[model samples]
Target: MNKDHYTYRVTWSPEDKEYIGLCAEFPSLSWLASTSQKALAGIQNVVAEAVNDMEANGEPVPVAFADRHYSGEFRVRIPPHVHRALAVESAEQGISLNRLASAKLAG
Candidate 1:
């Protein structure tokens, strides 16, 4: 897979005084540079080398988030007491329990 298809994040490091680039799909790899662009490029090069090494060693590369599918729905179970409290609160707010729960979880 091409490096462009992978996820790259560049964040400032106060301790290091430089931008740090990390690849989400390749969690073990990172790069630090003076500029965000250089950090990103460094991480991409690292990922390329890692991919080549893995292939040479017959190891599999990770699939990035861009290649995955998310349903945006999941099931969870909570205690009965919490459920009752949320239901009452949702009723008082004049909104469905699902909406209330979603809002609470989001924020």
Candidate 2:
């Protein structure tokens, strides 16, 4: 996998009247451009350079979380009332609470 495949977002900035490019893996880094495409490209280029610098300096590269695999399992903590409601609804629908919740989350 490419180490430079970091998550990025391009958002419009009303104040600057430009698009702001941001990288999730490097919160401290950002770029601005008049167009969203330019913003995205600029941030990607910066991220590539940063990754190269890290490699040259023997620093650990940030992992791209979207590339990670996941089991269909995770834990969620809900209030007692929410938990009870979900369980009751699932029971009424004749489905497991996990499946019901998973479907809701998927939507």
Candidate 3:
């Protein structure tokens, strides 16, 4: 996997008083620096090293989120009461249950 293709995010960490860089695909890894740019560079380097190590060990590397395909469908289990309430709401709005659920999930 191209480490650059992995999902990256930089955020301020109040507890550490530093900017934190994170990769979604490698949740266990993070980088902290005084500036966001350094934090992001640090995390990217770390991810590159990790990917190299994994490749050397013949471990399967994770597919980047950008390279993965997703269907519009997924399953979720809610309590019966919540299900009924959602059904009622969808009915009142004259929309299908799936549409209502999709809107709620997006919000």
Alpha-carbon local distance difference test for all models: 0.92, 0.90, 0.95
Best by lDDT: 3
Off by over 4 Å in 3: none
TM-score of 2: 0.85
Q: Rank the candidates by lDDT, best first.
A: 3, 1, 2
Evaluated with TM-score, which candidate comes out highest?
Answer: 3
lDDT of 1 by residue, 10-29 (tens): 99999999999999999999
Task: Provide the clashing-pair count of each candidate structure.
Answer: 0, 0, 0
RMSD of each: 1.9, 1.8, 0.9
| lDDT of candidate 3 over 10-96, digit per residue (tens) | 999999999999999999999999999999999999999999999999999889899999997789999999999999999999999
Model 3 vs truth, CA RMSD: 0.9
RMSD of 1: 1.9
Error of 3 at 50 (Å): 0.3
